[model samples]
Target: MTGRLWGLGVGPGDPELVTLKAYRILRDADVVAWFAATGRESNARRAVAVHLRPGQEELPLIYPVTTETLPAEVSYEGLLAKFYDEAAASIGALLDDGRDVAVLCEGDPLFYGSYMYLHNRLAAYYDHEVVPGVPSMLAGAAVLGTPLVSLNEMLTVLSGVLPADELYRRLVSADAVVIMKLGRNLAKVRDCVERAGLLARAWYVERATMEAQRVLPLADADAARAPYFSLVVIPSATAPGR
Candidate 1:
């Protein structure tokens, strides 16, 4: 019999935020797999490092290129597609050997997490389970001590990489917003927020729930220090109390 595949959401930076169900599966899985940048440690692995049982095999899926500024001759999308395909094959090998493989995701696996790509390729042929964990946006809101949406208010989650005009339109339409993937797009996103007249209401959070966490008004956030893990959250304009 082929071993089962598990996608474990390790939670946003904090090990304790991992759910009991996810923890149990993680400890029992025969092999642990994680995605990482070319030369960086895996954040998901770091979050759960202390809890991992000794002797479990580890598999690293390192990205060949993480930035979009690749050579004009190279196709970024094509390279990534091939990378994911190769990653799926490696994980499939472990599964076929009757060894249960657990892939660690930094946040909820389906929510902008790297595990989704592997899941899409392997699930059709294997028995798989996805264990959801705390997502970063909720962690950011918790750290800010601000309510996201009040009664009848719609909350929109956007990527900071969006075009300026598109970002502005969304910011203006949403009653509350969470813009993620800040990295190099911080300046553009900040500008869009200001143009939408929501700068004062927005708060920037970096690495929420982690040791290096920072929270400040979006307007005051330094663009140079904003990493991909950073985000800007705009709470509801109207107050709704218990």
Candidate 2:
């Protein structure tokens, strides 16, 4: 019989934020897998490192590229597709051997987590389960002491990868907004927020719920020094102090 595959959301940056189910699953899992940039430690794994027991096989799926511009002949999407295919095959082989694999995710599994790649590839052929965890946006809001939304207010979550004009359009119309993936795209995001006349109201948060957390106005953020773990929040008119 094939062993089950589990996608465990370890929560954003904070080990304490992990759920009871996730802790148990990590401790008992035969194999623990996490994504990381090449030559860097895995944040997902680090979140639950304390729960990982001795003899548990740790798999670091090192990404080939992160934040760097792709060469003309190599497309970023193509590279990611190939990487996911290989990762899925490796995990599938372990499952076929009756070894349960738990893939650790930084936030909620289906909420833009890298675990979705494996899920999409293996779910059709194997039994799988997803355990949810607290996402960074919620944690960031808590740390910033700001409300994400008010009564009847719409909250829009956007990726900094969006086109400048498109981001500007959405920012102007949205009641509240959270911009994520703000590493190299911080300048672009800042421009869009400025164009929408929301720069002063924007708050920037880095590594929320973690030891190295930072919360400040977007105007004070340095685009050149921003890290990938940062987020920008724009409160709605109905929000307190707004």
Candidate 3:
């Protein structure tokens, strides 16, 4: 009697940024799921709080990104694999009872979202839907007043953890670059942009629409110290020869 599960993108940090369609989906969903690592706050769930009514069930999936401290026995990926399997089993339990679940996603569901993991696990046995929301890169671009791309300009979105060689090559070829998860990788990323002669055009923004947002020209920020939510954008060079 229940309908399919929906993975809804709640947009960036600001609750106001949530899309109307995503809202309609969450407003009616019987169960809502979100992810949060140990000792951290659940911003994704907070982004959709207004839509949830009293007594509605909310589930939190504890997903911790493995760092080197973890032993090789269970391995980081192995542990995560277990978590995903368990999460799928739990969701499936609810689905078996005909309860439609809506999982909350920050930014777009497919763009570096955790919802994909849940979707992939349950898609085979359950009906599903994904509602796209505004991406942080686009929101960061707007906050900084930078045009993301124009005619014939390539746009590359890089995570903070990409290998140095791959990051350098892409920086050189792309007309515009938006590097997400700038956090601890800011120094390395900034250095690459500088070496590639794109430093003058680099800009960074953190938390996009949230009150604590930070926006800086790469030249002004002490790249080595930017926050985790920050990202950098490199616009096309104006002088072809310079």
List of clashing residue pairs for candidate 3: none
Q: Could you tell me the lDDT of residue 152 within candidate 3?
A: 78
What TM-score would candidate 3 get against the native? 0.92
Candidate 2 vs candidate 3: which has greater TM-score?
A: 2
- Local lDDT at 195 for model 1: 98
Model 1, 115-180: lDDT tens per residue?
999999999999999999899999998888868897788989999989999999998988999998
Candidate 2 positional error at 60, Å = 1.3
Can you tell me which runs of candidate 2 are displaced by over 4 Å? none
Off by over 4 Å in 3: 64-68, 223-225, 238-242
Which residue pairs show backbone clashes in model 1?
none
Residues 40-124, candidate 2, lDDT per residue (tens digit)? 9898888988778977898889898887887799999999999999999999999999999999999899899999999999999
lDDT for model 3, on a 0 to 1 scale? 0.81
Lowest-lDDT window of 10 residues in candidate 3? Answer: 233-242
CA lDDT, every model vs. true structure: 0.90, 0.90, 0.81
TM-score of every candidate:
0.97, 0.96, 0.92
* Per-candidate count of clashing residue pairs (backbone under 3 Å): 0, 0, 0
Worst 10 residues of 2 by lDDT: 233-242
Candidate 3 lDDT, 114-146, residue by residue in tens: 889888998877889999998888888888765
